[model samples]
Target: MFHIKRAYEAYIDGFQEITMIIPKSNKHTVHSYFELIYEDNRKTKLPIVTRIEFERFIKYTVFTPEDLSLENKYEIEDEFGVRTDLQVGGVIRSNDFDEKYAYDGEDLGASYSNHSTQFKLWAPTASKVKLRIYQSHGDEEKFTEKLMERDGKGTWKVIIDQNCDGLVYNYLVCVNLIWREAVDPYAKAVTLNGKNGVVIDLSKGSHVSKVNSPLQSKYTDCIIYEASIRDFTSHPLSGVHKKGSFEGFHEKGTTYNELSTGLDYLCQLGVTHIELLPFFDFEGIEENNPFQSYNWGYNPLNFNAPEGSYSLKPEEPMTRITELKKLISVYHEHGLRIIMDVVYNHVYELQTSNFEKIVPGYYFRQDERGLPSNGTGVGNDFASERLMARRFILQSLKYWTEEYDIDGFRFDLMGILDTDTMNQIVTELTILKPEMIIFGEGWDLNTSLSPSSRKATINQSHQLSKIGFFNDKFRDGIKGSTFSVQEIGFIQGKLNHDYLSDLLLGSVGINNQVSLFQEPYQSINYVESHDNHTMWDRLKLSNGKDSEELLKKRHILGTSIALFSFGVPFIHSGQEFFRTKEGIENSYNSGDTVNSIDWARAERESSYINIVKEFIAIRKRFNCLRFSLKEEIVRHIKSVKVHQNIIGYRISGIEEIDRVKEIMVLFHNGLKDTTIDLGNEDNWEYVWDGTKHYVEKGIKAECNKLPIPLLSTVVLVKY
Candidate 1:
């Protein structure tokens, strides 16, 4: 076969260049001439040859008539028909091109019915498009190819006019002279390992949980708990039968030593939402042997399909979809919302990705040197600002919420996406689920996108009011720098009043000093998550010289502050039970040995788990702690200086807060005990004496004269 990599018009009104690899076997004579052949059987002769070598490929520069157009699909013939076709490479990437061919129809993917199934794809630059349908997912030889007619406005479609349910298929789009085979980006169901798209009738009903998620009117009411499929159930003692699969996670009544584990344990923890790490069709872990490998699912392969490995029967495409919906129903049954961790920042393999294969240069952002941008520290940055790309993301988000009833979204590397796109996402998703919780990591990475304001980084928080961002300020303030293990914070023995103040106010700007966020609801207070070191491991690393007992106190104190602080609280899966990864900071690809949640530790540290549960209770009890607006916080909260190392904040009365009039939260960060006298004040009860709750049997004001414990947190209330 003759290899013609690409042909591009580098400069207008000049000769075009064709890049190819000519080995010694296919060496041409000096008199060898070239001609262009169109699909319509027209021909044009070429008289010039220019050669430049690159690695193994050679660039042959030649000229055709200025009047001749290269926009049509054609082939390069040596004389008449013994030739190769050149792929188009010089399609300009710009907003103008996207607008010209953007398809606004909702029927982009396979629309299935009992009688007819219509398939549509959006590929504007393609010369021809074909559909390849396989009778079975694994049968490589048994398939049929059908041509697709270009229906106006960049969409190619074909109506089977017969039932195609359960049949596997892929698109063979002949764009730029190369016939690229790719699964439909809009495919709702896919075959094992996501090799091909499966046609299924979504109109039919499937099994789901009967119970619904609790009403969460305010966004601040969310208490997010992050976990992964394998990490949650892969442990040998996890008491799950289908370990590391969706069925395993769905199985309830599981426990170790009678203490709840797996799905049951999540409900017992009292978190409002469970944010699962990417469970979509990712590019890691063998579906046949999921236990042999471990991946956090950050490497996205297909944007809209659920991962097959998590299903009980990955070989069957419908099984994956059915099981995933059942898992979501379980979360709903427990009054917990499910948030899917979506990775739209980059793809797993740029060159071989479905987006690149369907339309090479349209889905990615390129730099001035004509190379892909690597802002995500990955190979390429997904250009979400583009019209078509943005539409795809919005469509995908709608599919998950409407199809699976997912209650929220935790965007990964959200900074790589555009601000306008993020704003549109919340507007669209909330329309389906009004109480949807949308949050993401907003770190400003060094991506190639220009005019930084357009990117959805934290710096552009003002433009995004309804969306929430992971408050790194709160994270570093409580657990110290995630990068510098030895660095200390307020709860880590070192105190920065400014950092404490910023975090306590949910990173909302205070006293004319604009902070990381404009509203408290926009700040997601979290000290530990899937990324970086768990708070337990960080404590051990930072205070390694200290005894294990003291380290536990530090961990509890940091977690307590994050829980009670003003924004939505987030917890790692096994954080309450002192989850440790053997000090592995970045465990994205580390095997199950380094990533699995140790239920054995959950049994050992159940006391700390109780403390976390109580903290979540206290946060949910007080409306002042979960204020959504900046005005509510500015009007009701004020800083109090009681002692040298003790940081205290007071919350005045709010009508929404019932049974509690005024609240005072005190944190003692010193090395020694100190007396925090109440000045003989009456009715100043201790609701929480550092570690214990006293809502029924109040600890009187006399308890205030008692010396405060070193590195402890307490709540005082006057009812």
Candidate 2:
């Protein structure tokens, strides 16, 4: 009976062979041979069969079964009236199979030595492990040397006296009288993408020993700039050599300048953070070539390693790290914080991954039917609930913060992570860096994962306390071009009942207001980001007009509203010059053809840039505009009224006399001329208007009723 059970289980893949134990109590004769039948009606019987020893149980390895053929599918039946069906499937076999090759050893405390080297790897299943080191001068098999033996937990370590810097190495473990090869899990530097494990000397190449400079501040106050490294610098306008590489970020006359171009722009635009797209090592799924072309960097192969393609020199990994450090240093120098986009949701599904080669079932989430679930739109979604999976994510984040000097992280699709694990990580990260800006795409894409209780809402949705969310409501209301005039009228200072006010005042019609106040600073407010069309593009598509002046005014008004609104404001890069992607909203996988910002537009539309600059300066000048919601300083001045096309709102802080501090914003969307009644205010004076001609001093005197030209927005100060 045990032999039959083992043979039945052996049908599955990954089970190379099976051993069965038959009990002596079973009343069966040796002459009654085992008969097996497939689903196709094919039958076979064992010609030589014998009974086991007269013990309670017997164990022996069954003869290796024929490799499963596509035509083989059937049932099994024996003379003892035992019968079962054969189904093609796979399973992970553990007890008899030893997949591990290394062991966990004593804690080798942090080291800074140049000549000495330490190695560590985790292999819980191995009984004995040997470290094989190859001499640098010859074939690996010719000059082999055993360095050290593994410890009790299956970890092996060795520190050689010779300069073993660039040596190729592998672990050979003896399991059940068989020896197989395994790669060292903890190798800092690997060769041939881990096909042939090689040791690297950290002192060589561009590895820098000094601690990286601190970021400007925590990322809660940042305005993100999401860009692909390759697409950002490969164009002729980029003007850099290590084009699209990490070193290119330091190239004097390229997009790095444009990256910093928005520093003063953001400082004036009133933003505190800059969330960069994924900078981790990833393959280009766009062009299919792993070495070149544009990719969002989602297919992560190595968690600890940087993307080598982003380095000027592919042979040197240290150069990538050094260049990234310098980029972070420069952002820090300019008082701009950096938040990296992290994708630990899944890994590339190629042949060279640890998850694919060993213990595949342990890494990914399985469906109810016992198949891997591909919910993340990638090949598979990681099961964060598993102990090993949880440790991998946490360790990766810690390595980035401690090694790369990252200010914070924006998790991509954080909802896939288990609730308990997400909370644990939030707590750990907060403790590590109290002000770390942690946020994620809280909504899950899979219907099975997204329960009614788990769906994301702006302020009330997240399970983690310190982590903020990207408020999609604010994004939709202000810039979701599909909204009708009625909707716009409800939000843009019309329909005085204030529907937009509800969202603005921290209640976005969701549950659990308690979490809303826990950290409202966690919310990122913006009309546009890298994922969506530029606000300008949306406005043009909605209004059906190409009026440059009107476009400039609308741009200023949208940016001004975002800067002065409640939560931290984020501006997509190139928005200051009225950048347009020509109305392509979902350009995620598109090539450089559709996504690149036209730098020439800035020169042609200098007036638009000046308007944006002035609006930013205005936002910077007034504390009332940038005040936190806790201040409770906003008072609705009901004296101002709204007409068919003109709308006005008054905001006064604690101070009233300072011209630079007090602000009254009046906006006109009407096509025809209309007079706006200021309700007899005594000290109102014209401060700034969207029109380029308004910058001149005497222009205010020549206009009728502040002369708000068609589709113009104006800002005034109480003298």
Candidate 3:
């Protein structure tokens, strides 16, 4: 009489090595001989000669089962009275075994056509799988259930002869005799609140792909504006009929206080890219009262489907798809590229997610003791190293790019992902759309990956050659730390000449002998984004109850440095008008009071907005600001430290086709105004003075004795 504990078989060069974990309780009585029964009912006795003893169990390996096939369903019996059936997936985690051989199925979700619908699920360890179909999302009464058959690939599949369009479904999987119900991981659309996966024809035509955006030769040419779909138009004064909806984001010509609002305002701002924070299906926020709840859309529920809360009809599967497509088309038609801020790092709930429920422990990284890894600090980090996990991410990216015609992607917590996935994404997407802007927040997070593995962090940016990262060094060097309200940066009178020079050169290789990137385009220079306090609030808190005038000047100075810096420039939606969340550091889920843009405030701060708009025009007018190559940057740019509080730079080597031959930029962080002597004899035209700007013959170009206002940045051009 023999009993079995854990049995697995590994194949190497047509030879099978069966390993078994036998409990220490039966060690003395257990026999070294084992018998294997194949599907043909033929039994063969083998000797388990080698044994590695552990405190709780004994590991035994036998090399006699050389001709056993991986697909053969077999049984094992040992002399210690242990007996059990064998499974191919049981040995996938054995030491030195290739885990890549773990069985996977590509068509593991419902696939529908006009004539028939087929459903498949990859559950190697499960004894049974069933499909349940309902007429609609809410109609659960007397729904139909169909049995599925297991295939050679370990996938359970079924095909319904009739068309199953306009139906909602879920799977009833029986794992080890315990039944569990789950939604499809590859669902293209979901019902309200993500209750079930919906089946519908995705062939509905839209004009999203036909719209074109203004092209630039380099990634540095893009100036990104980040906004949330709900917060963008949730205010009552937003002047759009469909407030807090996708339609509102697409609405044009709306105004508040006689100033253009919504899409019209963005067009007026002259931004080249609009980065929307997480438009995917996210948890939380009741769809009934969308305005009552507010979120930055970081909690992702489904990677491929749009959020129902932002759609006109939350119940209909095709509603969100059509509306979001319309919104993208509208932005492209206005010559604006849309960048989606994707959050694939973690999920809202781990156990309930489709990825987890569909495949038990395959999608996430786990420790040796089988505990989930918390590298993202959000409980569970996705395991991009796994083949299926990598494939899922790559497939989702392709679907978005080809279906929606999106211009770019901003990955959230990108450092948690392995470098191989990021590089693979860039390689694949470039083939689809050349010159697409790709960047993200590559903060070094605690992850399971080793330090040398592919990471998208600032220190490891060279590994991801084409991807850009939000330059925290440039952010803190220009404005202040994102975490603290008391720490003041350069604009608040804490100037570091060496650091400023590095940031101005895009933090590229060796401008100040300390660089965070290999190329200028790899740095996204910004002082304010959606994650932290606005520049206005930072100055107010750190500068200590400062006067409004002084705060305004400091804010302008910070913006000037960011816009003028090398690499891509990113701005928050209302940063131009000094948007504030009432000193709240993390306003991700706060309601409209703290999250809305307050178009009224933007109206009052129109002067500052005008300055920012002018700065963008100036940045675009000069080719020196958008240099793409490292050699060009080193040769064309020069910086000098005039004083502890003053720094100046001269940018030359502009192409003959450019409007100006050379430009001088000066930054003064002192409390009082200062004048500097220009080394050159050529007359310098004052193109910008922080508060004012001139286009032609700006204030009579003077090479010597140039005055810069207190806490100001100036740009002078010379032909």
lDDT against the true structure, each candidate: 0.80, 0.54, 0.79
Off by over 4 Å in 3: 1-108, 122-127, 149-156, 207-209, 484-487, 655-657, 693-698
lDDT (10s digit) by residue, model 1, range 1-719:
12444322222122244433344334552324577666787878775477665564444555666433334566676643356665555433655466567787889989998999999998877778899999787887899999998887788999998888887999998765568899998898888788898898765436554457788998888889889998899889899888999999878899989789998888888889989999999888788878777888998988888897888788877778878888888789778889999998899989888888887788998888879998988899999988889999999999899888989999999999999999999999999989998989898987878899988987888998888999887888788899887677787777766557667877877645568888888988888998899988888888888888788888888888878788788888888878899988899989888898899899988888888888888888777777788888888888766787877688886645756677888888887777777675667677677754434447665645746778888887877
For model 1, what is the error of residue 73's alpha carbon versus the real structure, in angstroms, after optimal superposition? 4.2
RMSD of 2: 9.8
Tell me the lDDT of candidate 2. 0.54
Model 3 agreement with the true structure over 1-719: per-residue lDDT tens digits: 12333443222222366666666765453557778877787888878767887788777777664655544567777775466665443343332222423444456577889898888776655567788887767776858898988775557789988877777888887643346787777788888887788876777745345687788788988999999888889888888888888888989879997899999999999889999989989888776666667777888887888898998888887988989989999898899989999987888878877777655666777765568888787789887877667778887888899988889999999998888999999999989999788898899887776654566677788898799999998899888787776667888888777777888887875444666888999999998998888888888789866688888888888888888888899998889988889998889877888988898888898888988999999889888878766777788888867667887677886747376778878788888887776657665677886455554555755557667779888888877
Whose lDDT is higher: candidate 1's or candidate 2's?
1
Estimate the TM-score of every prediction: 0.90, 0.71, 0.90
Which 10 consecutive residues of model 3 have the lowest summed lDDT? 6-15
Model 1 RMSD, rounded to 1 decimal? 4.3
lDDT measured at residue 205 in model 3 versus the true structure, 0 to 100: 45
Q: CA shift at 645, candidate 2, in angstroms?
A: 5.8
User: What is candidate 2's lDDT per residue for 1-719, written digit by digit as tens?
Assistant: 01224322213333333233345454642334545565666666643233355445543333325543312344545567665544323323222222332112223211224566555444433334566775542354555656454444334556655555666666665422234565553344444333335555544633443333344333333445555556555555555566566666545534333332223433443445567778776555322233334556777665666666665554444555567777776666656667888887777772345554333355676666656677777767776655556666776677678766777888887766666666677777777777677777765556233343443323234455566677665566555534442244222323332434433433222222233443345566667777767777777766545576656666666665565455566667667777777787777667666665454555566566666656556655655544434334235232235455554456664364344434666556555555655444545566676365445332332223455655556777753
